[model samples]
Structures are given as structure tokens and as C-alpha cells.
Target chain A: MMTAQIKEFPGVGLRESDFEQRKVLYTEWVPNARYAWDAGVAIGRYLAELKEGRLIGVRCRHCRRTVIPPRVFCEWCFRPMDEWVPLPDTGTVNTFSLCYVTWDMRRLTEPEIPAVIDIDGTHPPVGILHLLGEVEPQAVQIGMRVQAVWKPPEERTGSILDIRYFRPVREG
Target chain B: MTRKVAIVGIGYTGCRPLTAEVSYKELVYEAAVKAYEDAGLDPRRDVDSFVTVAEDFIEGTSIFDEYTPDQLGGMLKPNVTIPGEGIHGLATAYLQIASGLVDVVVVEAHSKASNVLTLPHITAYAMDPVYNRPLQANPIFIAGMEMNRYMWATGATQEQCAQVVVKNKRCALYNPTAAYGANLEIDDVLAAEMVAYPLGRQEISPHADGAVVLVLAAGEVAESLTDLPIWIRGIGWCNDAPSLETRGWGRAIYAEGAGKMAYQMAGIRNPMEEIDFAELDDTYAYKELQHLEALGFCQFGEAGILTAEGVTEPGGALPVNVSGGNLGCGHLLDAAGLRAVVEVVLQLRGEAGSHQLPDVETGLAFGWRGLPSTSGAVVILSN
Candidate 1:
């Protein structure tokens, strides 16, 4: 038997009424539905580009910086990104993680390896985060060169999945 | 040596899983008003500086700093907003007072998560767009991965992780303001809906709506205002590698580093024996265990077994999260850290009511910024 010293302090004990009040108050404040219109359009555009087998990023005219995951404005320069540049799919892996569990905690028979790729052909090391396919998790190394694998044109959506995963490229 | 700072007054709005009766601004004002009254000072005249903690992504607004002053009664005060946890904001306030730059500082943090339409989508924005977001993997999945890694590294079991939720929620049953309090069995937690593999909904903290405010003053100022002033004995905060993949997911290196820094400053070597109680961040059940190891409460991976053995429960060895923690109380983002401080102050002052621990001469409060972001703060408070 563990005898831990217990001290008494003054205040009301947890009241059933308090819990009931809090539960009701919390449920009532929850927003039932929320939608982002711009995000939807952005996804549609990205999916369309993916189907075309071209990797595009939004470039800021003022800062001349390209964002791989294209955005309307350059976060750094606070300027609208109007130029769409097709970026070379080859890049080096900056970091990666292997996920052995599913979103809902069901153990996966096969794990997925995701990597942050610093794609070539862009200033300031334009990077994109995506799946690392055709490579063993143990073999994948930081700074290893990889190339993007595009899905067939018919199945391409301008979304990120358009390029299935980045595969290791053999250097000449 | 720096001038000591003390918490002269602390006030919190009743916490609920959600609050629809008031807007975010109104919620902040209610707590700020209570804190001002408790300090026996008028916010408009006495407060020399004001600090608020909020995140643009969480609040679903850009330039969130612009909207804080109107509600906090800082119409023309030196107010700055921090884009992190409330403890970071409090630490900033402590520095300002120690520098003799401010005499009295008010720190406020609140969350209105219930106002957001889609929390998952909002959280998805935090993911790396090129790879991680493409998978539509929920943020909680990262926690799952980390929990799995922690267990593998430390040889802890799922049962131990589930026990954390069981312990915290049960402790919360003694806290009147805890939102998720209930009589729960460990099996109940294990059987709850799994949001991510190895992680269940019960393992995660419910989103909550509430605000917490604290009035900080220099030692002399505090002595003049209040009979009992909880001294800020030590404060430490640090950030680890931002790339989640590059860092070890199982252990909290940042928290361990921060805790050590704080303990050193507070002259504490044996934390388990020196500290009376603690309020650790339990955003996820595994987080509490991970932090316990990091905070040196027990050996690595021993938290699971210790928790299963009822070591963290009230009346157990070094009671933890007596205010129910984020799991039972609710996750209020920036306010979560301040809530820990508030609980510690309450316990130390013997004002915690039903949830107070044994003679709390020294209390520690810890906060974690959560996944994909590695920031933590450790504050040691004493009466």
C-alpha cells in the first residue's frame, strides 16, 4: 500500500451541476459548418496543372521568388504572385518521416514515407513536401537527389497527388 | 541578478468545451475585467504594459494583433501580441518588469476554437503543402507517429498511455471548471473513437473556449498590493528543430532542455522531491508521459508504468494536472499555458478548493507548443 501524503485545501468540490453547465455551453458554441471559397479554387487549379504533367509554382513579380506550393501572394514580400513557372521535378530531400499508422490509429500493413523536397530550378531552394516512392525507408538519405513521377494525363488533377511520389534519380 | 516578479492577481473565465454566448473580444474582456478587479487596479489607469497571445491560423484571422487592445482595455498602453502560447507572453511580461521598464503588466490569452468551421482543414494548413498535405493526413497523425515512436523507444505500452487520460479526467472531476470531466475507466478510453492509429479521440484534448488573465508586478509592487504573492522563481523557454522529421519524435528534447534551465535557475536538482505539484501540458495523452520523462519526473519510458500505478493522481506521488489538464479542461491554445500557471498559483495559495494538493511550497508549470512546432516553457512558482 502506497501511503502518499494528502493535504486539504479550501474550495467547492467538482459539482455535477458545473459539469452539466460546461457541457451545454461548449456544445452550443461549436460552429456547425465552415467553408473556404478561395482554398477550393486553389485546389482546383493545382489539380488541373498536375494532370498536364507540368509542375507549376506561383512567382512573385516584385520579389522574384517562386513558391512551389503556389499561393496568391508571396508571404515574404507581401506582393501578388502573378507568374506561373514550370519547375524541374528533380530535387534533393531535405527531411522525411515514415508513418506506420493511419489517421484514425489503425495500424497500417505498409508504411508511407513522406519527404520535403528542395526542388531544383528555383531561387531560395523552392521546396515541395510529397511522398517518396520507389525507395526503401532505410536507404533514403537527406540531400539525396530524386525526380517526380507524374500520373497519366487523364488521371492528373492540378493537385499534389498529380505527381505520385519522388523517385531516386541515377546521376550520370 | 534580476528583480523578482510575482503574480499579484489571476483570473479565469469558466471554461467550457465551447462558448457561444460571447464573441472572442467579449470573452477576453470578461477575464481581463476580473483580473483587474482582483488586483484592485483599473486596467485603464494602472496597467503600464499589456501582452496577448494568439495565432493567426487558429483564430482564422490575419493581423490578429490589431483586434486585441480594444477588448483588453489597452487603448494607449505598450501592448504587443505574441504568436505563441500564453506562457511565452507571460515570460515576456516578466522580462519587461524585471528591466524596470514596466511596473505592472497584464497578460491575457483566450481561444474561440468553436467559432472555426472546420478545425481539421484549418490544422491542415500547418502541414507542408507539397508532400504531407497532399496525403490529407490529419495533424493528429503526427502525434500518433510520435506516440508510437515514444513507446518503441521507451518500451511503454498503449495501456499506459490510455491511463494518462484516465488519470487526468478523473482528476478533472474534482475541478469545477474542467470541461471534459467524467468517471472514465481506462478501457473506456481505449475503446473511444480512434482519430489516428494508436491515438483515440479520448486521448486528445477537446477544443475549448475560455480566457485567462494574470497581473504581474515587481516584488515591491506586489507586496504593496496583495498579502499573498506567488513568486516567479524561475522561467525558461526554448524551441527545437522546426522540421518534425529531423527531430526525435518520441522524446521532448526542447522541454527537457527548458525544464533543466528552469530548475537550475530555481536551484532545484531533485524535481520529483522538490516540487510539490505540477501542471503539465497533456494536449495528447502521450504528451504527458513524454513530458514527464523530459521533466525528469521519472526515468525514460517509466511514465507509462508510473501513470498506470497511479503516481500522477491526486494523493499520489507528486500530483499532476489537478485542474484536469488540457485533456479534461480543454485546449485554449495561448491560454493553456496561463491556465497551468493559474492552477499552480491556486494550489500554492491553498485556494484550489477541491483539487488542491498537499502543502505546495513549490509548483512547476510547463507548456508545449505542440507538433510541427517545438517550443516549450517551464515556470517554477513558490509562495
Candidate 2:
């Protein structure tokens, strides 16, 4: 039995007051870095189409998978994608969550419903991560049909946020 | 049978919610010194190369590699930083030794997670900027969604997930290095405040500050260094599509792919029988079941049933995470994988003391870089 000497764990748990005092003696810096992120060739076209109230995906003939959030190359085949395929604005909810917290770990009074909406026309099971609106948290279910609620044409931007959210598409 | 790599020595700081007494550099130095001393070799002379694992965004320092080498005694020697997780560093060291390029290598990984005030936001930034990051929702929801899908697909109830919290935390009680170990009932886990639907506060591993340093040597070098070196049998890592749009909601393709590669390399045909035990990523409670299935421990839905039947307990058949995993030991981020490796090595050496298991010969350690991405690494070890 090789029992090593167990030393008292050398970590300290401090309160906000202790942290504040320590910060007073040292210089603190806040990062405000910004990025211009070029949308690149594939996503550049995808976002441009989103601004025009359309959803499109790139097609790879080799793998025969139509992928959303389009990329220039087929991740599976490692070949340049050739054709663009327009997809339906409506889709099914693959999965969802009722979140009571924000990205910064702050509590929210109302829960945010984030979900993966599987687009209707894509060959593969391609689902985009986005928010769900106009539906009760308890009402959300996997395979539930939904449609994109786009921002008015005049206010649309070349971004994912161009479509505000996905809402339950009423059954006819 | 060209060459064999073995873990000659291992050292790590205790897991804690905060390490305010020392800077991150000092933490690395502490572990490095202990590991070198344990191996009976001076890193300044014996270590041919070095690898450190860290993610820049979490550290608030861009290109954090610049600050690593000096602390590990790799000053001007061949040292490189891996921007992924710890198991990846171990794999890199394993490759270096097997390639006949280095006789001995040092692998270091650490996390000063307490220093990051906006961890969730920082992690959310890892999402696709054009499609996912704009949602501004808490990243835990990703786990929530996955858990929901997993439950629906595998019949794994939330109660079963809570049971995992109970089991791992209870196991942690015997581990002196486990900081978040606790005694609680499954009901307690269920009653904890919900962070995201189906995922409660207790179900998520709290972040901790810690570091792990390991020394690896090839063949005779290992034989000369330590009488009880743990041999590396195999290693593998893989990633699913980096986009949320294409990833499977109910399965862990990454773990399956990585585990298959490693199993093939190790010549392992029946993992559940041949491998003595395992330490897998339990950063999220439900992930234990998910990874178990992905690693081929059982069929797609059988892991939840096995957990309910006590098949994964320390004394049970095919023991898993006997070291309490990330759930009880606290999540060490990039260092998390090494924590599992450290536990596996100690158990294999019969040096885990109170937590030691009898007659264990081989073990597996697996790690995932954690969400918004689906990358994983696996390493097999034997005594």
C-alpha cells in the first residue's frame, strides 16, 4: 500500500469582498475585442438568401447530402460543393429546451425556448439551432411542425437573426 | 509491436471550486515538480518534448501557450500548446513516443475556471457565428435538448439521470482529492433548482481550478524509470460535424468513432469484459448514459437500465468513474481528461488508497471538449 501523505488542499474560496480588495491592488483589464467575420463563399450566399426571405443549402453530389448552414466543402467527402438547393421555410422540431438562464449565466424571469428545427427539404437530417416563439413551453414536442417567422423585408439583415424565430405552423 | 508507451509518473493539484492562493503558472509548476520527482527524473534534463492543453477564450489570454513552457522547465526545449482538451495532449505525447522521435515527454493541462466570470457566454461564442451564437440563450440548453432527445429515444427518465448524480457524488466521498463530493438522495438531486428543462443544478458539474502533469516514456526508458509504469494500450479521438445543424440530437457519434479507433488499436474485441473499469466524461449527468452507449459498454438504451440496476457502481460489474468523475471532482475544463487518467493510473497501481479497487488490470479514460462542439478523445491503459 503506497499511501502518499495527504496535504490539506491548497485552494481558497473567497467572497466578493475579498476579490474586490485584491482587485484594488492590481491593474484590471476588460477585453472589448470585435470581429468582422467574413461570411465566406458558402455562408455569404446563405445569409444573402436569408435576407430575401429564403433558406438554401449546398448540395454535395459525392455524398448526396444537402447540408444547411451551407459550407463551401462537403465535410464528409472533402470536396467542393457544386449546386445550391432551396429549402422550405417550414420544418419539424427535432429537439428543444425551456431555458431560464441567459448566456452570461444570469437568471431570467421568463424561460427561453431554444430548439433545433430540422428543415423540410434537406436530404440529411439538418436542423438549425434557433429560438421558438408563439408556443407554450409545455407544448413543444419532437417532430412538431414549425415554420420560420421572418422579419419584414425592409428590416431584414444578412444574418441568421434575419428570421426572428420559428413558430408552430398551424395544421390545415 | 514497434514500441510501447507507458505513464511513468502522474501528479495533479486537488480539485477545488477556486484556487485563489496560487496563479495558474504556479499551479502548473506545483504539479510538474511533483510529477518529475515521482518519476525520479529532472524534466530539465530528461524531458525531450512537452505539450500543454488550454483554450484561449476561457483563459482571457490570447495565445496562452506563450505563458506555459517556462513553468514546466521546457524553457527552450521542444514544447507546443494544444488548443483542445487534455486527452488530446496525451494522444500527442503517445504519438511522439511511438514515432521514435522522443524517449520521454511531459503533458500538462490545467484550468483556472474560477477566473472566468462569463463562462457560459464564452462557451456560447464557440457556436457558429452566423446561425447559432445570435440566439443568446444559455448554452446549458444544448445539454437540455440532448437530454430530452436521449430520453425520448432511449426511455431514459430524468430520475435515472438524477441517480447518476447520487452515485458519482457518493463515490466521491472516499476520494480525498474530490472537492464537490457530497452525500445526498436522488430526491435531493431532483429537487435542486432547474437550470434548463430536465437538467437541474446538481446534474451539472461545477467548474474547478486544478492542473495535472504526466510523464510518458517509451519501452526501456519506462522500464528504467518506474517499477510500476501503466502502459498505454491504445488511443483515438474524433469529431462530429462542428455545426449544430448537422449533429445528431440523440446519439454521440463522436464517442463511438473515437472509441472504435482506440478499441481496434488495442485489439479489444469485448470491451465490457476485457477492460476492468473506466473513467468517462460526466460533465453532465445524462452524458454518462450517452457516452456509455457510445463507447459500446451496452446497447443504445441499456445503459440507463444498467444504472438503475447498479451495474456501474465501484463494486459492480464493469465499474465506471469510481473516482467520482467530473460530477464530484469538479470540472477542470481542458484538464478534465487528465483527471480521469490520473484516477485510472492510481487505481491500476493500487495506490488510490480508500478508493482503490481490487485486482484491476486495465482501464479506459474518455473526455469530450464539452458542448457547442462534438469532439472526443479516448485512451486505454493497462498495468
Candidate 3:
């Protein structure tokens, strides 16, 4: 038999105040982790098109799957994807979350609706994550039709946010 | 055929919410000492190689593995670091021993999750710097979004997800190492402060601080160290596409692929029958159900129903996460998976007093490298 078998969890627990009371030296690190990730061949053109107020995707010759935020190579097919295709800014919500917190656990006064929008002309489940705007939080539902609300060309910086949040499309 | 590998010894330090008294180095030393003692071997003499799992950003240190040798008694030995999950480290150890170049291997994984001042900020860096990081939403929002898709596709409910918390935490009450064990009810989980819609604060696992070390040896080497060795029947790990946009949202395809490989290796034609129990990745409560479905323990949507019907309780038919899952035990970043292995080891050895189940021969430990990574691994063990 293994000796000194752990019958109880052997770790010392401390309260938040214990550090202050014990005068523990806590060091804070502010890391400047900056990187200019090359959007590469696929995303470079994709971002360029986004700045031009358009959406784009790539078609894989093997799987025939349309990849958005396009990649130079098809992940499933593991082959080069040279076909660039234009896509509509309109799409449907594949999934969404009404987040009440920010990246640093800070509370928000109003919940942010982060969603994965299935853009038109792409595979059903393949979508980019973006926020939803101009729709009631309660009114948001999965599969609701929406269109991207783009920023003015002057304010665009070839970033994903060039097309701001998506809004629910009203039926005529 | 590949040679066999067995986990002859195991030792763990914690699944505690905080471990401020000791530095992460001391925690690693304590765990390594216990593991060596349990295996009845000297690390410098008997162990051939060492593997530790860590990430530069998560540890608050660059080249973090450089500082590992002194504490593990691994000075001047072959030591490697994997920046993936605990099971990945273990798999590497298994591979080294199976190659016959090494007789025994040590695998270590730990988390001082409480050390990082801005954990969410560090986690944000893991997101796709191009598409996802710019969103700046809480990373737990990903869990909420998946939970929504899972529920929408499978008919799982908020209440059913809450029951997972209820069961896992209640199971934790009997587990000594589990930090967040509670007598939680479905309402308590449901009523807990909502952080992400369709997901409450209680549903998300709070981080814990701890280290786990396991000594694995090949056939004869294993028997020489311990009479009762938990044999590694099979191991499998897989990942989805690098980008979240390209993968299926509702299904744990990684788990499915990993399970298929592991089950095939173990000759498990029917997972629901051949496997005795599982300690799955319940990083979020819904993940337990999702992983269970992916592992073929039940149909896609039936796991939530099983949880609701008491089919997954400790004494129930499929008894999942008897060590309280992550919900009850508190998660340990990359080390969470190896902690689950310890629970299964104790149970197989009939050393899990109070929470031990009877007549159990085979068990499984599945782990996920949570958030912004869809990597998962599965290991099946038998007594």
C-alpha cells in the first residue's frame, strides 16, 4: 500500500486580509504584450474588404466549406484556399450571451449582448463573434436575422470593429 | 503492439481556493515529495524523465520550466515542459516510458491561480488577437454562448444545468480535497449572481491553487514499485480548429474524437457499459452534460436528463465526477485533469473512504484546456 496516503486535502488556506495583516509583499506586473498579428493572405484581404464596407470569405475546393474571417488554407481539407468570395453583411444569430461583466470582472450597468453571427454565404455554424446592437435585449433570439452596422469609412482602421455591432433586420 | 504503462504512485497538494502561505515552488516540492514517497523511489535515482505543464503568461514568468528542476529533484535530468493541459503532460510521460528508453517518468502540473492579479486579463491574451480579443468581453461569456447553443440545440434547461452544480458540490462534501463543496440546491445555483446569461456565477468554476505529481512506470518496473498499480488501458487527446469560428458550437467534437481513439484503444465497444464511471471536465456545469454526450456515455441531450434523474450520482448508474467535478472541487487551470486522475486512483485502490464506490474495475478521467482552447484528452485506467 502507498504510505502517507492523503486522507485530507493538504493545503493551507488564507483569507484576502491575511496578506495585508501578514505584510506580504505583493508585486504587480503591467506587461506590455503588444503584437501586430499578421492577418496573412486571407484575413488581410478580408480586413481590407471590411474597411471597404463588405464581408468576405474563402471557399475550400475539397470540403466545399465557406470559411469566414477567411484562412489561406482550409483547416478540414488541409489544402490551400485560393478562392475569395464576397459575402452579404446580413446574417443570423447562431448563439449569443448577455454578458454582465467586462474582460477584467468589472460590472457593467447594461449587459453586452455578445453573439456569434452566421453571416450570409457561409456554412451554417461558421460565424464570427460580434456584438448585437439596436435590438432589445429581451427581443434577441437565436436564429434572428441581423445586418452589420458599419462604422463610417473615415473612422475605420481595417479592424473587425470597422463593421460595428449587428442589428436585428426589420421585415418589410 | 505498444507496451503497457501504469500509474504506480500519485500525490497532490490542493484544490484550495487560495494557498498564500506557500510559493508555487514549495507547492511543487510538497507534491513531488509525496509522490516519490508513495512510489517508494528516489527521483534522482529511479525516475528517468520529468514532464511539467505550464504556460508563460499564466505562470507570470517567461521560460517558467527553467525554475522547476530544484523542487522536483530533477536537476541534471531530462525535464520537458508542455504548455497544454495536465493530461497532455501525462500522455507525454506515458509515451516516454512506452518507448522503452525510460523505465519510469514523472508528470507534474499545478496552478497558483490566486497569484495572478488580473487572471481575466491574462486569459484575454489567449483569445485570437485578431478576431476575438478585440471584443473585450469576459471570457466566461464564451461558456455562456456555448451553453445557450447547447441548450437551444439539445433542449437542456437552466434548471438542469443548475442540478449539475447541486450534484457535484454535494459530492464534494465527502471529498477531502474538494475546496468548494457545498450543500447546494438547484435554486441556489440558479439564484446565484448571474454573470453570463444562461450561465450563473455558480455555474462557472472558481480557480483553485494546487499541484499534482504522478509516477508512471512500464510493466515490470511498475510491479516492482507497487503491488496495486492502476494500469493505463488507453489514452487519447484531440483538438478542434484553431479558431472558434470554424468549429461546431454545440458539440464537443474534440472530446468525441478523443473518446473514439481512447475507446478503440481500450476495446470499449459500448462506453455506457464498459466504463464504470467518469471524472469529466465540468469547467462549467453544462460542460459535464456536453462532454458526457460527446464521450458516448449517453445521447446528445440525455446527459442533462440523466443528471436530473439521479443516474449520475456517486452510487448511481454512471456516477460522474464523484470527486465533485470542477464545480465542487474548484478548477486548477492546467492541473485540473491530473487532480481527477488522483480521485480515480483512490477509488480504484479502494482508498476513497466515504466516497468510494464498490466493484469498480475501470474508470476514465477527461480534461479540457478551458477557454479559447478546445483541446481535450481522455485516459482510461483499470485495476
Give one digit per residue, the lDDT tens place, for model 2 in B1-383. 45899999898997988776666766777788789888988776788999999887877768988877766878778988888879999999999999999899999999888887777767877876667765767788999988999999999988889989999999999999998999989999999999888889999999988899999999899999889999999899999988777798899989999999999999998899999999999999999999999999999998889998899999899888899999999999999999999999999999999999999999999999997779999999999
Candidate 1: TM-score?
0.69
Clashing pairs in 2: none
Kindly list the per-residue Cα lDDT of model 1 for residues A1-172, writing each as its tens digit. 2334546546757778877878432322222246332232333455567778877777777776776766544445433467777787899999988889877998976788888999887777868889999988889999999999988888775568878899999889
Displacement of residue B293 (Cα, Å) in model 2 is 0.7
Please tell me the TM-score of chain B in candidate 1 relative to the true structure's chain B: 0.97
Q: Estimate TM-scores for all models.
A: 0.69, 0.70, 0.70
Model 2 per-residue lDDT at B265: 94
lDDT tens digits by residue: candidate 3, B1-383: 67799999898996988776666766777788889889998886788889999988887668988977766778788999989989999999999988877989999999888877777887777777667766777788888888999999999988889999999999999999899999977888889898888889999998998999999999998888788999999899999996868978899999999999898988998998998989999999999999999999999989888889999998899999999999899999999999999998988999989999999999999999998778999999999
For residues B1-383, write the lDDT of model 1, one tens digit per residue: 68889999888996786665556765776787788888888777788999989887777778988877766778766889888778899899999999889889999999887777687766666666654656766687888888889989999888898888888888888899888897888889999998878899899998788999999999999999999999999889987776766876878988998898888888999999999889999999999998999999998888988888888888888788989999988888778999989999999889999877877799999998765667899899999
What's the best-to-worst order under lDDT? 2, 3, 1
Error of 2 at A164 (Å): 52
User: Docking quality tier of candidate 2?
Assistant: incorrect
Q: At residue A61, what lDDT does model 2 achieve?
A: 93
**Which fraction of the native contacts appears in each prediction?**
0.11, 0.00, 0.00
Local distance difference test, each candidate: 0.82, 0.88, 0.87
Residue B153 displacement in candidate 1 (angstroms) = 0.8
